[model samples]
Target chain A: MVDRPGGNPRAAVVGTGLIGGSVLLRLHRRGLDVTGWDPDTATRAEGRARGIPFPDELADAVRDRDVVFLCGPLSSLPETLLTVAKHTGPDCVLTDVGSTKGGIAGFAAAHGLSDRFVPGHPMAGAERAGLTAAVPDLFDGAAWVLCPAATGIERFRTLAALVIDVFGARVVPMAPDAHDAAAALASHIPHLLAGSLAGAVADADLRDAVLGLAAGSFRDGTRVAGTPAVRTADMLLNNRDQVLAQLGRVTGLLDRLAAALRAGDAVALVGHYQRARELRLALLDRELPPVVRDFPLGGDSDDELAYLLSLGAAGGHLTGCRVAAGTVTYTGHLSTAPA
Target chain B: MVDRPGGNPRAAVVGTGLIGGSVLLRLHRRGLDVTGWDPDTATRAEGRARGIPFPDELADAVRDRDVVFLCGPLSSLPETLLTVAKHTGPDCVLTDVGSTKGGIAGFAAAHGLSDRFVPGHPMAGAERAGLTAAVPDLFDGAAWVLCPAATGIERFRTLAALVIDVFGARVVPMAPDAHDAAAALASHIPHLLAGSLAGAVADADLRDAVLGLAAGSFRDGTRVAGTPAVRTADMLLNNRDQVLAQLGRVTGLLDRLAAALRAGDAVALVGHYQRARELRLALLDRELPPVVRDFPLGGDSDDELAYLLSLGAAGGHLTGCRVAAGTVTYTGHLSTAPA
Candidate 1:
C-alpha cells in the first residue's frame, strides 16, 4: 500500500447528505480518520448510526482536519464553505462535491480561500438522496471532475490524488468555466429535456393513453424527469448561462426535426437519425482509465485467500504486497470499476 | 385452449424480419399452421432455419391461408399490402404490424380491400432488427393497437382476438387517425427527441468530454437514438402531421424551460420539474389489465404434472381439462405474460 504522504491525515465532511455521507463513508472504509457534521440533527444522528463519527458541532468537526469537504445543496454551498473556512486548520485543504463549480469557485475567490479550495463534482447520483442513500461505491468508476484553483495547484493536486486513490474515481481536471459549460451540455440540458418530455404528456386527457401505452423507450427517456424539482431548479439556476446556451442549440435541432416531419422530408429525417446513431454508438465504445487501489488484507486465513483469489478473477492484477505481523497488504488494479 | 374460432386457421406472414419472424415463430409455437415469405432471401433463410415453415413464392404462401400479416418496413408496407391483396384468398383477412396506420389504411381503402384489412401496430421493439433479432415472446404484455377497417369490424375483431389470445398482448382498438395521433405523442416523438438530444452532443469539440462523463440519465434519455435511421425516418414521414404536432408541443415546453433558466426563475423551473415528476410517478403506478392466456398442457406424466404445477404457481388458473388415452388437454390462464 502507498503510505499516505503526510501520515494518517484527518478529514472532515460537512452536510452528511447523500454526497457528503458517501464521501465520509468511503473515506472511513479506506481507513482514513474522518468525522462528519450536519446542520440537521437527524441527519447527523443518521450518519452516526451508520457508523460514521459525527460531531454535533460543526467547529469540532473541522478543527484539526487535514482536508474538509463541503457537500450540501447547491444553493447553500457558499454559506457552508464560509463557515468551514473559519474553523478548518490553516494548512488544511478545502473541496466540495457540488454539481456546479463556477459559483463555488467564485465564492472561494471572494472569501480569499481560493488557494486552499479545489472545486469538484462527481458525475454520479441516484434518484433518491440523503444519508440513507449514501453508498461507499457511489463514486467508483464515475468521472469526478476536479477544477483546481490556479494559485494552489500543488496543494489541490495532492488532495485530489488522495481522494481519487481512496474512492477509485477517474479524475479529470478542467477549468471551472469549461467544466460548467460541458456539464450544461452533457447533464443539465438532458435533464431539462426529460422533464419537458414528461410535461408534454401531463395533459389530463392525454395522460391515461400515453401512460398506458408507454414502453421502455418512453420510460427510459424520461427517467430523469423523476428527479426532485428543488434539485433540478438549483442546477439550472446555478449554471444559467451555459444551460440556456445548450437549450438554444437543442431547440435548433428540434426545430429542424419538426420541419423535416412537416415537409415529409424522409431523407433529412434519416440523416439526423443516422448522425445521432453513429455518435451514440461511438459514446458506448469510448474507454476510460482503469481503477486501481490498495486493498488492506486483514489475514492469511482460507477465507481471506479465497477472497483475494476472487478479486483476481474479477480482473484485478496484484501489483505489490507487504507482509507485516499477521496482516497481508496487497495493492491491485480493478477492471470494471463499480458504479 | 380456446379452439380456433374458424377451425385450424392457416396464416402467412410476409417480411420475416424481426416483427414478422417473431409473429411467425410465436404462432407456430401455439400450434397454428403458418407459413412465411420475405423478399430478403437471407432473412427468410434465417427464419426457416429457426423451423418456421417458408414457401418459396409469395402467391403460394398466401394461397390457402386464412390470414396474411404484412410486417415489412413502414415505407414499403403500402406496396406489400397491395401485393398481398392480389395474391391472398378472397375470404382471407389481411393485417399488418406497421408503426404508422393512416397510410396503410388509406392504401387498403383505395385498393378496395378495406373489407379484409386490419391496420395494426404492436408497440414493442428492440434497437436491433431482422430475423436474427427475433424473439418469440416479443409481443407479450405489450400494447398492440388494432385499427379495424370501417367496413369489416367483426372480421378484424376476430383476427385481433386470435393474435392477442396466442401472443398474450394487450389489444386496444382505436380509429386509424386517433391511433396515429396517440402513437405520435407516446412513441414517435419520443424517438425523435432522443435523436435530437443525441444530435445536440455531436459537435466535435464537445464529443469527447460529453461521452466520457455521461451518466445513467443521459444514456437512458438517448437510448432510442440508436434505432436505425431508415425505420425512424419511415415512421416520421408516414405520420407527418401528428408527429409534427407533438414536436410543436414539445418545442414549446422546451422554450418555456429555456426562458425560465435564462431568467433565473427557480420557482418556474421547480414547477416544471414537479409537474413532470408527478406525471412520471403517476405513470409508474398506473394499472393495466391482467394477462390471461390459455396454456395447453402437453402430457400427463410426472414431469408434465410438475410443469403444470409450476405454471399454476406462476398465476395461471386452470380453466378446462380433458383426457384421451395418455395425452391430456388442459387449458389454463397465465398470470404473467412472457416478453
Candidate 2:
C-alpha cells in the first residue's frame, strides 16, 4: 500500500457489499485511515477477513470519521444513511453510493442534515455481486456523480476531492432530481424497453421460429433484459416518477411510428426514422469538449454550489481537485451539434 | 472455375446489387453459367468490371435461363419478377432476394405464375451497398427462406438445392405468411423499438447529460437505429400488417410494466421479468436437435409441400439436398423445452 499526500480524510463505510467493499479496498490501498461496518454480521466478518478493520457497532466505526459513505442496499438505505448521519462525529461529512438519490436526499433535507450531507452514484460495477466481486480499481476512470447543495458545498468539495484524487474518478455534480431524470433517460427506460422486447419474442407463437430469425438487432436490444429481475424491478420502482414520464415519451414515439407504418405513409415513415438516425449520428461523432474551468473551494456560498450544479446539468465533468489548495477543475463534456 | 455436376440450373441475376452480385459471384465460382443485369448503367458497369457477364438488356440477360432471381429493390420487385418471368425460357423457375415476400407473392398468385415463382429471402448482406461489397461467400452458412407454394413444389426443390449446394446456404421452406410473421417478430418490431430508444434519448432535454448516462443497454438497444431510414421504413411498411400486430403486443407489455411500477405491484413486475429471463436462458442453452429426416423429391404432391412448410414452421432446417438423386435432408432446429 502506498501512502498519499496530506489531508487524507479519515473514512468509514457503513456497508461492505460490492460498492462499499470496493471503497474500503481502494482507501486501504492508499494507506488512508478507513474503517468498515456492515449491519450483517457475515458481511462484517468477510471484511475483517480481508485484513481491514470492521467494528461491531456502526457508531464505533463511524466515530471520529471525517466522511461516512452509506453504501447499503436501496431498501435499507433510508434508515442506514440517517443512522450513520446521526452518529457521525461533529463536522464529519456524509455521502452515499445509492442508485436513486431522491429518497435518501429527501431524508437528509427533512432531518436538517443537508449542510453536511451529499448524495452520489458511482457509474461502475461488476457483473457479480458482493465483496467477492469488489476490486480496488473499480472506480478508476469512472463517472462519480455528486449532487451538491449550497449548504453542503464545503463538505461537497471535501468529498469530491476524495472521489477524484483518491478513487481516481471524475465527479459530475447534479441536483438530486435532475440526476434521477437523466438516469431515467439513459439507463432505466432502455432497460424497460429491453425487457419488453425479450418478453414479446418469448411470447411469440413458436420460440424456435423467432430464435432462428434473431440477429444482431434482436440480440443487442434484448441484452439487458437478462439483468437480475430483483435489481431491475427495484431500479424501475425506485424511480418510477421519472421513468413513467420518460416511458410516456417513448411510447408516444412508438405510437407515431406504428401509426405511420399502419397508414403506409412512406413519407411520414422515412421522416420519422430520419430524426432518430440524425441523433444517433450526432452522438456517435461527438468528441469531448476540452474547456477546463476552475471553481474556488471553501467559498461556502450558494453561488458556488449552483455554478457546480449548472456545469454538471450542462454535462461538464470534474477532471481534478486540489483540496489543500482549494480548487475544483472541470471540463465541458460534449462537442456535438444538437440533432 | 470448378464445375458443379448434374442439373446446375442456368442462373440469371436481374439486379447486380449486393445480394444479386453476391449470387453471381457464388454461381460463377461454382462454374455455373450466370449472367447479371442492372437497370442502373453504373451498377451494370461495376458488375462487368468485376468480370460478371452483364448483358445490356434484361430480356437478353435472362434468355434461356433455367432460373431467374429478381434481386431488385422492394419497390420494383413486382415488375421486375413479372418481366423476367415473361421472357425466361419455358420451365424456368423464378425466385427473389427481397426482404418482404407478401407483395411479390400476391402479384405472382394474381399473375398465374405461382407454379414457377418461388419467393425467397436470403438472410445475409454486407454493410455497404452494391457490387463493391459483394462477395462469393456472402450466403455462406446463412438461412435462405424459400416460401414454397404447392404449385411451385418442383421449382422450390430445385432452388433449395441450388441454394444449398452452390451458395452454401440452408434453405428454410415457409408459407409466405409465416415468413412475414416471423420477420415481423424478429426483425421489424425490434428495429422500431431501437429507433424509438434512440430518438427518445436524442430528444432528451440535455443530450450530453443523457449520453453520459448511456451505457451498454442504450448502445445495444439503439444499435440498429442507425440503419438507413429508407431501408428501415420500407421494411416496417412492407410488412406493416404483422409489424403492426406485433407492435400492439409489445406496447401492451410496456404498458403493463408501466402500470405495475405506477401501482408498486412488485409481484407483477418480477413475474413479467421472470418470463423473459427464462426464455433468454432457453435460447442460449438450446442445443441443435440432430434428427435428420429425408423427404423424397419429385413427389410434386401437396403432401410434400405441406411437410416442408410444417418443418419450417416448427423451425426445422434443411441440411442438404440431392436434386438428381431426389431427396432433402433436414434436422429439427431447437431442442429447447417451452419457456
Candidate 3:
C-alpha cells in the first residue's frame, strides 16, 4: 500500500522473535515477498497460526529471496548466517540485527560472505520478548545502526537503508568496530553493570527492604537487566572485548567519583552534578557541544534556589513547607507565574 | 468518621508542602485538629483555602498541640527545631519527616530536647510539588521509615505509628544513623549520580538522543533528579556524611565491577550477571528481605517465552518468517531452575 518499495524482492527473515517479526511486518507491509523460518517448529506453527505466512522448509523460504535478515540471538547469528548463505540466492544481500558488530563482522568475513552482509542493530525493544510481543510502532522513532561489511557491496548498503527505512527507523552508518564500541558503552556494558548492581545486594531480607524503598533510581539503573537471559547471554558472549573495554572506561569514572566522595570535596561533588545536569539538559534539547545555562535565584537563598529560580521559575514555584512529622518540603509556583 | 486521632493533639506541621499536606489531609480525615504554618504566607493561605486549618502564629500552633511534625529541608531542621522548642509544650513529642536522620538526631541532642523528637521519612512523593498536588493515598503501599529520636517520647513513637497507619503504609523502625545511611545509599547518592551522568553528556543531540533512547534505564536512574532542587539540596546538605560514606561504598563496588570488565573475564562478567539475577529476583516477592530487594521489576511476563533451543528441538520457538517478514513467538515458560 505504501508503494511497496521492496516489492517482489524475495526476503528471508530467520528468527520470528520480537525484532525479527517486527522487521518482517515492516517488509511485508512494504510488499516484499517474505518467508519466516526458525529452528523451532512450534514457534513457526504459532506464527502461522497468527496468519503470517511461514514456509515449511528453510531452503524453500530462502531459495529465491533477494535479501536475508539474520535476526536472532547473537550467539546463533553466526551459524544461522552460514546456513542462510548456503541456501539463499547468489546475489542476496545479508544483514543482521544484533546489538554489537565487530565480532559479527569478523564472523561474516570468515564465512566468505563479507561483501553480501551488512551488520545492523535497531536500538529498539521492550522489556518483553518474542514475536507475539511485536508491535508496528516499535521501531518508529528508533535508531537503526548499520555497520557496512568489510568487503563492501554498494547495493548491499542501499539494501540496508531500505531495510532500515522500511521499519520506520533512521539509518546511522558506522564502522563495525566503532559501532561495537559505542554499543558497549551505551548499551551492553550498561546492561551488565545494571545487572551487577542488582546482584551486589543479594540478601533476601535486605533486598526486599531496599526494593521496598526502591523508587525511580533503582528502576533506571537496572532497566536493561530485565532483558531475557538468552539475549543478554548472547551479547555478553559475542561482544566480550568491547564490553570489557567500555567497562574499563566507566570504572575509571567511577573511581574518580569515589575519590571525590571520600575527599569530602563539596565543590567536586557539585562539579559532578553540574556536569551531569549540563549533559542531561543538552541531551534534552539536542545542544551540540553540551552547554550549561546559568540563571540566578532572585533572592540570596542558596545555590539550589538560584538554579531553581534561574530555570524559568514558572507556575511550578518553590514553596517551603513542612509536612507530617516535620519533614520540610519546598512547594508550589509564584503568583506571577501561571499554575 | 474514622476516629479523629489528631483532635486534642494540636499538630504543628513545619514546611507545608506536598508531603506535609498529604499528612495533614490524612490527619484531618482522621478527625485530628490540625494547624499549619510556613515561612511563606501564600503557602499557608493556599492550605487554608484548600480547607486545611492554618494557625494564626507559629508559637500558637504548637503551644497546646500534643504532637508537632517538622517537615522541611533537612538543612533547616535544626533551626526549625530550636524555634519549635522555644514554644513547644514540655510534654509534646516532636518528630520530623526528613529523609536523613543522624543530623536531626544530633540536632535534638545538641539542643537539649532529645526526648521529644522522632525522626521519620516517608518513601513516597511525586514530580509535582505543592499543596494542591497533595493526595490522601500519597503514602499508600509505601514505606514509612521511623528513626527514633534520642529525646523522643514513647507516646510520640506510638503517635507516629497511629498517623502513618492511616496511609496504609507499613511502618519500619530503624536507627537514626542506619536510616540516614540507608536513605543516602538508596536515594541521595543515586540522584546525585543520575544528575551527574545526565550532565556529563554535553552533546545536545546526544542528550536528546539519550533521552529518546532512555527506555527504563535512564528514567529510573534519573527519576529522583527530576524532583525539586529544594529536596535534593536538603538531602545532600543534611546527610552529607552518611551520603558520602555510601558513595564511598558504591564507588568501591563500581571499581571492582570495572576491573572485572577491563580484565575481559567472561566468567567474571557472567558472575556479575548471575549475582544481579539473584539480587533482582530476591527483591520481587515481598516475603524476601528488605536489603536486597531494593528494586523490583513489577511487570509480569506471563505469555512470554525465551526462544533458546535449536530448530525442531524440544521447547524451541521461532520468531520471524522465512518466506515473508513475519514473526512467530513461543508462548512457554523458562525452566524454573534458579539461575
Best by TM-score: 2
**Judged by lDDT relative to the true structure, which candidate is superior, 1 or 2?**
2
lDDT of 2: 0.79
Between the candidate structures 1 and 3, which one is better when assessed by lDDT? Answer: 1
DockQ of each: 0.32, 0.50, 0.14
Residue-wise lDDT of candidate 3 within B1-339, one digit each (tens)? Answer: 112343455566777778887887777777667888777788888878867768768887777676778887667788989888889766777778888778778778787777667777877776557777888778876666655432333443355445544556655555666566556655776675565444433322233223323433544555555556555655676777777665655555556655665565556656666666665654443342212101111232211111111111111111111111222222212122232
Clashing pairs in 2: none
Task: State residue A250's C-alpha deviation in candidate 1, in Å.
Answer: 1.4
lDDT top scorer: 2
lDDT of 2 by residue, A1-339 (tens): 012345677889988888889999999999989999988898889889978889999999998888888887777887887788778755888888987889778988998888888999987654346787789999987778998887757677777778888898878889999889888877788889888878877787856676665666777777778766777788788898999988877888888888888789999988878888877776566566666666676554666667677767766677655443556665435344543
True contacts kept of each: 0.68, 0.63, 0.26
On the 0 to 100 scale, the lDDT of residue A180 in model 2 is 92
TM-score of each: 0.81, 0.83, 0.71
Better of 2 and 3 by DockQ: 2
Worst 10 residues of 1 chain A by lDDT: A311-320
What clash pairs does model 1 have?
A: none
- Who is ahead in TM-score, 1 or 3? 1
Which RMSD values do the candidates have, in order? 10.6, 4.5, 17.2
By how many angstroms RMSD does model 1 differ from the true structure? 10.6
